[model samples]
Target: MSARDGLDADERHLLVVDDDDRIRDLLKKYLSRAGFRVTAAADAGQARKLMSMLDFDLMILDVMMPGEDGFSLTKSIRARPGRQTPVLILTARGLPDDRIEGLALGADDYLAKPFEPQELLLRVEAILRRAGPRPVVQRRLSLGPCTFDVERGELSRDGKPVRITEAEAQLLRTLAKAAHAPVDRLALAPDATDATGRAVDVQVTRLRRKIEADPKNPRYLQTVRGVGYMLAPDE
Candidate 1:
């Protein structure tokens, strides 16, 4: 297996370097909601500072900045003694040569500007998935009357195992990672399936049956109206 296959969704850290304030903030918020710890930098200088302080899993860079453009910084990163962090470059320059230059400078992937956030997310996932599989850390999450163990893929209440399907376990793991935050249904199911939104709703309903004391009025797993589902684990 390639190094990318080892990366798990949880515990992935990203560094987003962009000069545009709006794009930087938007990507930061969006990726954070998607269950990744994202740190933003306004330019190459700030990116260098952050890189010196932290070890990031991946980086999202913009090419056309005021100074020290993405290509130069990518080349510098590649030249570093032991820095092989995956990089995905974003720029308004859509020329074939521009993409070639970015990739040649050690970028793992490149996307032109005016792209959909969903598409950007898919690219990020794709790049990270290629790195390698990450070790699965066992964690026990509290949900009012029950405890869900991520490593064992088991849920128990009052010392008894509560039967749950594999799909349900996967859904719970995804939600538990971002507890108290709304998770988009599209993030839950990325495949081109018909009526995916409705399908996620069905899955949520089934999950409620196993966890909620009253499925009609859930306590821990609550729907955020037009947004999506949020897991408010018991404190």
Candidate 2:
């Protein structure tokens, strides 16, 4: 599968967790044709089992299930120490509040039940683009209570996302590349050619608020005095 929208389709593995056999099969077929490797589970139990053995690029979880509901499952997954898997929730009860709750619970996107296959594909592709790439490398980095999945540009604390802005993610990506070493402020910008030192510092302070227990005295992301900043991987 060729890469689409910066997504390496050949390496994209999606987990479809739905108790409805008809919907699950239909989604699996549709998404597979769209060049994603789809794995379907009948319930959260089976989904959790598959998750343990595989690293999925994204998960499509249903809101209502027999034992463990999608909300609870998403919460549980987000609560894990290192897993920052993106989740897209599906539900028949597509109230405004429901969508808000799902988003608040750390879901990347949500789809109301009875959505068209094409719509689903569109949303999936959009989310994948927003989620970014899975670069082929030793890409996982620990930052205290949080872990950064370098390729995915995801930073999470105990599996819950820290919600860094795009620029901040770009900065972290640069810092993560040279963990234990200082990265120049200009080099931390999304575009080093146009970024100002003050802009970089502002972003660093924002990131520290999320990653550091005390932003005043940072532990993980540290200023290197005159050299710029360093991300110490010790914590």
lDDT of 1 by residue, 60-104 (tens): 999999989999999977865333789999999999999999999
Cα RMSD for predicted model 1: 15.8
TM-score per candidate, in order? 0.55, 0.57
Task: Return the TM-score for candidate 2, rounded to 2 decimals.
Answer: 0.57
Clashing pairs in 2: none
lDDT of 2 at 166: 68
Error of 1 at 139 (Å): 18
Error of 1 at 219 (Å): 57
Alpha-carbon lDDT, every model: 0.81, 0.81
Task: Tell me the lDDT of candidate 2.
Answer: 0.81
Q: What tens-digit string does per-residue lDDT give for candidate 2 at 156-193?
A: 99989778776777777667766787866754552335
